[model samples]
Target: MRSGVSRRTFLASAAAGAGALAGLLPRPLRAQDKTVKIGFLAPLTGPVAAWGKPGLDGCQIWAEWINAGGGINIGGEPHRVEFVAYDDEDDPAKARTGATQLIRENDVKFVMMLGGNSWPGVQPVAERTGMLFSTLLPSDLSPSTATLIAPAEVHPIYNVTAVDWLAANRPELKTAVICAQDDALGLPSVATYLAAFEAAGIEMLDEPLLFDPATTDFAPVVTRMLSKKPQIVCLDTCYSDYVHPICEQLFQQGFKGQILSCTLDFYDQVIAKTSAEFMEGTLFQFPDFDDPALNADFINFQKPNEFFAEYNRRHPGQWGAVSWEYASVMDLWKAAVEKAGSAEPDAVKAAMTEGGEGLHAFGKARWWGKDLFGIDNALVGNWPVVAIEGGKARIKEFRSIPDWYDKHGELMKKHMAAYNQMWDQRG
Candidate 1:
């Protein structure tokens, strides 16, 4: 408050209730003074349900927590938030339609999306409406586009940490082969993994086995990747919908070597399907909230362990890529909004930029990148390299991404070029 109100005092005001956002919400969702609406667009009924719905469910709990705590403060009042979810079903056209409905019909102020083609589909609507958009995939980022951001899961940039940790620790694991769907998120990740493997001096055996989204059976794909017999098999940003089948196939095929991927969700189910031993050496980017390493430096990681315990108690036996992701974005956004003392998209965006090297849930980090996603705005920094330990995923190390970019910047370019996915050609 320029009125001499302390930051804590202002937040305390917002924490007072939904009335904090009295003038902020769109006309429709605003009723009495007790509610604010947010849009959760994800692949709800599609093959990607494991990745999408469960994550939105996490958002439900986040909203509940905030509301229970009073609500979010915009300037000096409390606004309890509500999420209005729409299932885009992972289709670009459906994503566009869902976004339009969310803004025009539901009147949501902030729209959280699974953010791939869905991002591109919904961007125009966001631009026209001045809605703040958050995406998990930084591939949606561009300088011309002002609203979209990847604050939580910075996709491929974070993936580099996993491969780096693998190379240094498991030095004997030399050769690697990769497989992933050929799309905006998948292809960039594959390119990054190829570059990371090169930087780590881990030979990429095959030219990267890519599959189509229409592929429901992962057996053939797994068979082809295993044919390379590389010490490690990299699953490059595959949707959990695909990860499960591929992992099951890998287990069936008896792949005993190191397995590296961007995510491993519904891990208990995967263990039930593939058994505990085979899934033991798996390396991934996202980690469980219960990890002790998270307790050290992350602020928005507020009670991630508590969140995990609660989520397990309620939903039990289901978690996926998007889990904790959109919620993490909210945590970052809250800090930025508080820093700016406003919720206007441009104002908040400026505050995020001014913060300079903002620290996210993974600890201290900077937001810098243009060599890859064509926008330096995507938050880049230390990412934890998670590995399976005693049947539970744990952060083995937090690796430096800027260091990797320094060493193999051009290698990443070569791989991206090889796949013809230079972000310009992307939709």
Candidate 2:
């Protein structure tokens, strides 16, 4: 990747530019005196808050940018964007209630979700109301859920790209062991990692060490995983809550090998807890937006470096995997609403998937996943394989998730079925 401007320099320039623009135009431009509400329903105050709260923070930034820029144009009119947020705490009952309130009371046109434990509760609401919903987890998609779409962040499936990169670059680290908190998020990820490892010709030292989500002490879990002496320790889609303690355990125990995970959210904290040298070369699927690679031509995010700088300035030490994901979904939704000339959920959904393709964060992607998800709802494309170099998360490469599936999809399906994670099995 080409070297980019420093964050401090970039932010300084951005601030100057904004100040210059403000003099030329009215602040908080409202072009048409209209407003559109979007719903952010997810776990914002529990163990999963890392994913939910940071994403909402990013959405606030997105809304400010859009509203200040004269809002989204639908046909010939501009509509200021507003987000209605609800904290589900990853609880099903709360999620159901929150979804209803967002749709019925708040009159939100679109709802975005983290989509794991809370998805079941919102699925029925979507079906009943015909309200379009977006999920980070395409694993939540099925034939019965016509209103739900996975427009961004195809989780677990994207985990395969990191393993693929590892197997090619770190071939010496062959044997691996995996572990995850046994939950909606962890089970599917465990299966995906198993499939990815198998396809890479890496032997799993043992079956995935599933643990209770309630378990706080990770010392024993890390000890059992390290007992086999595997070169790679895979932390399957564990929440940031679980990943932090487990990584600390790995560092304390002094196992020098490759570390892989679906996400290394708040990794700076991890490095601080351990050591910069200890976290070096660790691989995962999400990159810090300030990574120079995000400035590449094909990347669909808007001014990622600026966004990253602004996010840090406003909410320091809070950026995580989902920080930009919800904003990314809003980008797609805005484009679709403009294309369809309406903010109606069905119209926007149809327009978003009009050509069976979408502009994913990394690049252009296909509306795939019928064979696996029982619906062509997921926008699958290249996903970044991130590694910690010099104590900073950087994008190593963008690996094609669909390409890997084309070659080893059956193996993945087999593993998903074994874990009862396949769409049919889920129902």
Query: Best candidate, lDDT-wise?
Result: 2
lDDT of 1 by residue, 1-427 (tens): 1111111110111111112222433333223445668888878775555446666666666666666555666776666678898999878788889989988898776777767766767777777877778777787877656677777678877788888887788899999999988777788898889888888889988888888866777888989989988789888887666777888898899888998988786566678888888889799987776788877855446666766666556655543444565666777776677677776677777887775677666776677666776776777777888888778988888887888888888987788788776667565
* Model 2, runs deviating above 4 Å: 1-32
Candidate 1 TM-score over all chains jointly: 0.86
CA lDDT of 157 in candidate 2? Answer: 94
In candidate 1, stretches whose alpha carbon ends up further than 4 angstroms from where it belongs are 1-34
State the lDDT of candidate 2 residue by residue for 1-427, as single tens digits: 0111111111111111121111212445544478999998977775566557656666766676677776777776777888899999988889999999999999999998878889988888888999999887889999998889998779889999989998888888789999998888889898999899999999998889999977878899999999999999999887777788889999999889988888787788789899999999999987888899999999888678877776677667656676666667777888789889999988998999998999988999999999999999999999999999999999999999999999999999999999999999985
- Candidate 1 backbone clash number: 7
Query: What are the models' TM-scores?
Result: 0.86, 0.91
